[model samples]
Target: MQAYDAQTLVLCALADGPLHGYAVNTAIERLVGTRLGPGSLYGALSRLEAKQLIEPADDAGAQPRQRPVRLTPTGRQVLERELRSMAKVAAAGLASLKVNPA
Candidate 1:
């Protein structure tokens, strides 16, 4: 099971598409509305790495020592499953709201 929060999980999932840490952080800020702290960021990175969901890639073309992140097949599968499940829950909620609008 993922130990990270929804934000961390989503960030990791997005990095699967390939992005350096700075870019990842920036993208996350854009998606989430606030910058992530170092402790939480690294902690989530460690957990994702341990789970084999995301891996570090060479940053030859990156800005200086920036390392890129890539998602593993397992990570992709996990994210897909999570997305589907979340969608289902959202659908149910929407259906309910339709019946009882406020």
Candidate 2:
């Protein structure tokens, strides 16, 4: 997947709740039937954090590498908007091919 796609997947994975790095990858795999490479995963996480879309969760006793990350309010809003836009595109594409969504 493209870099932006990876970032979006990361956001979606975190939508339900905070998840540590490995959990996020697992969640994404469950959603999309494929796993991201370590580089793609960490790169997306770093980009999202840099953009203030995600933040490390407060698990006081957890190691830094094991700490989970949660979506910020802005991140949730962004994800919703992005999903809506994608849905519209998908609908249009499906209609063009006369294929009904499952």
Candidate 3:
């Protein structure tokens, strides 16, 4: 799918641990205050699975329809790297901006 941003957000959301769809959406909302629609959420999940960035951990005590997902070791590494890149970009952007101090 074309949800690159959503994929990133999903990956970040799963960084904490395994969570199903609703829980994943909740975690993402907590982090970014943006609620992902079902389509976007599922699409991102599918793409990440295809890329091997995420995997089905286990259902365990979850509801019949709830399948929790977790990040693979590679996924964690990729997320960490992406966060570092984002931080650098944010720092550079802030450095380039002119702030007027009173």
Top model number, TM-score: 2
With a 3 Å backbone cut-off (N, CA, C), the pairs that clash in candidate 3 are: none
lDDT of 1 by residue, 1-102 (tens): 223364345444364477765667777767656656777666666677788987777665665327677778888778777778877887889888885423
Q: What is the TM-score of each candidate against the true structure?
A: 0.73, 0.91, 0.85
- Looking at candidate 2, the ten consecutive residues that score lowest on lDDT are 58-67
How high is the CA lDDT of each candidate model? Answer: 0.66, 0.92, 0.84
RMSD of each: 4.9, 2.1, 4.3
Off by over 4 Å in 1: 1-16, 60-65, 99-102
Pairs with steric clashes in candidate 2: none
Summing lDDT over every window of 10 consecutive residues in candidate 3, give the lowest-scoring window.
Answer: 93-102
Q: Tell how far residue 87 is off in model 2, in angstroms.
A: 0.2
Residue ranges of candidate 3 with Cα displaced over 4 Å? 1-4, 60-65, 98-102
Order the candidate numbers by lDDT, best to worst: 2, 3, 1
**Model 3 clashing-pair count:** 0
lDDT of 2 by residue, 1-102 (tens): 533499999999999999999999999999898999999999999999999999989885787558899999999999999999999998999999999997
- The list of candidate 2 runs beyond 4 A from truth reads 1-4
The positional error of residue 36 in candidate 3, measured at the CA in angstroms, is 0.6
